[model samples]
Target: MKSNKATIHDIAAKLNITASTVSRALNDNPRISDETKKKVLKVAKQINYQPNHIASALRSGKSRLIGVIVPTANRNFFSSVIRGIEDHANILNYKIIISQSYDEYAKEVLNTEALINARVDGIIASLGKMTENFDHFHKVLDKGIPLVLFDRTADVLDVSHVILDDHLGAYQAVDHLIKNGCRRIVHFTSAQRINIYRERKRGYEDALKANGLEVDPALILYSNMQLEDGRRLTEETLQNKVHFDGIFSSSDYAAMGALQVLKENGIAVPGQVKLVGFGNEPFTSFSDPTITTVDQRSISMGKITAEMFFEILNNKGAELISKKTIIKPELIIRDSSK
Candidate 1:
């Protein structure tokens, strides 16, 4: 009642049971009778008793927690993935701690170190945009924490990854444009440092080449994938007389910006310039002209990423399973593309 803290001893004293018995009941030990466990749980809840996770970790050598790092939680894709992780991890009796990197490499490093210090049994992460150096993850490996990289991954790292096939997704977007008789196409991309972007860029090029169109270096512009970047590039290309009948953007947000600029300049969406984008963001469909884009199956990706973590954990660190799971993306047709 004084409210310093509620402990198991308090619950035991109130219930007139041994602290060990209370502990067992709290843990749902099969040896404890259901009636006793129910009573103990009821009293514990009344007293607002909190378990000593640190002590439990010391006893079992595990925190029964998983650390998750995402580029940005504000984005729908990452948030959906986190939801999937929570749903699956909850079934496994594991709690989760989430951290956002904000697409910064330095912040990612710091967040990971903090997660390791928390004694998390495993980590599920989507690497930041500029994480060229994966030494921090290797440190996670050195500490024997099972790590699974999802969405964005490092090819050089010897870890399991769940990723969408960005190349094929990009090819599909571009090929769809080609099918609609879009000859000259402009590709707006960002963060070429990340493998996903690089793969998407490659797909855009190969699709153009396969369709007997020359890969135009001048048409491809890399930016920060921000709304302003999309607007600026599209505006500049229009002013520079870059004849582009179609525009393919790597992000839906940017595509939305480009769409605005196209409307301001009296350009028809599918009639004059068919447009496509990546990442099936919610705004894609809600926009004036629904955006034709690629769906990365983010929920399924998150589910499998968590499953991969359990796979490594079930092995009990005897072997680091370096498996790669790639999901092929699906193209969603909408009003913006014919």
Candidate 2:
């Protein structure tokens, strides 16, 4: 059976020219006249021509494709980061392949292997919560591929990364609550050993001490920082008679959950219990009482992460001396914290 797929040879025959000339025209070789290039492109569209990216990569030793891995894409933060990366990728004529880890270690490892097999020019990734072994990422470096980690990164991994000042962001949130007369505040945070959460917890404690408030272990609640976790923690606090005048959560979803529970129990926000959250998620603004949160500067983080990847690639790994870039966080004030 004969295939109907159009090739450069078919285009050449249609234009009464050699295949080499058609190829050069398609490649926009300076020697090929603009008139010829335009004609070739018109014919290509008419015939539904597709360029062989694999063949081009084989010839040029560059796939011109970037692979990105995220814990999950459902959040606004990760999506915005992807948009920032796309902004630069469009101008550089590079294609991006995005994979979601769903915060599973096995899934993350599989995604990394798959990307490596795809021969991507480079990879940008955020470590999954369950990931403890860095061998999969090490394989990428072992194969001479560039890997750039963003947001949730590991300090042990001797690689380039872009992150926000989690400590400062958390400190700002706690400080804001304290200034608002939240003398006995409840903190919801993650129990994971992840640096971001650890730093955030540190900031929370530091802010309390700075304001001459005692750091009460009973006020600290550890969980996955999900909506259910927040609700359960808040409920337990209410039931156990823990005296808390405010709630500061490390996740917006968690904070929203706490708010719902508080309102259900007839607790007035800012009047009885002030609230603050992190991750400036969209719903924080439109809630009945707006939420005060910290902006992670995700877009800027993404742009810087992509730029660092390119730098490593262009410099042939010379810039991979474990350079880390930290973006500042902004504290967004709203009704919840007022």
Q: lDDT tens digits, residues 256-290, model 1?
A: 88999999999999889999989999999998789
Q: Could you tell me the TM-score of candidate 2?
A: 0.94
Best by TM-score: 1
**After aligning candidate 2 to the native by TM-score, how far in Å is the CA of 158 from where it should be?**
1.2
Local distance difference test scores for all models? 0.91, 0.91
lDDT of model 1, residue 6: 89
lDDT of 2 by residue, 1-338 (tens): 99888899889999999988998998789999999999999999999999876777777788889999999999999999998887888778888999999989999999999988778899999988888999999899899999899989998778899999999999999999999999999999985578788889999999999999999999999988889999999999999999999998999989999999999999999899999999999999999899999999988888888888888888884644768899999999999989
- TM value for model 1: 0.97
lDDT of 2 at 281: 96
Error (Å) of candidate 1 at residue 325 is 0.3
Query: Candidate 2 — which residues are off by over 4 angstroms?
Result: 1-5, 18-20, 317-320
Name the lDDT value of residue 177 in candidate 1: 98
Clashes of 1: 0
TM-score of each: 0.97, 0.94
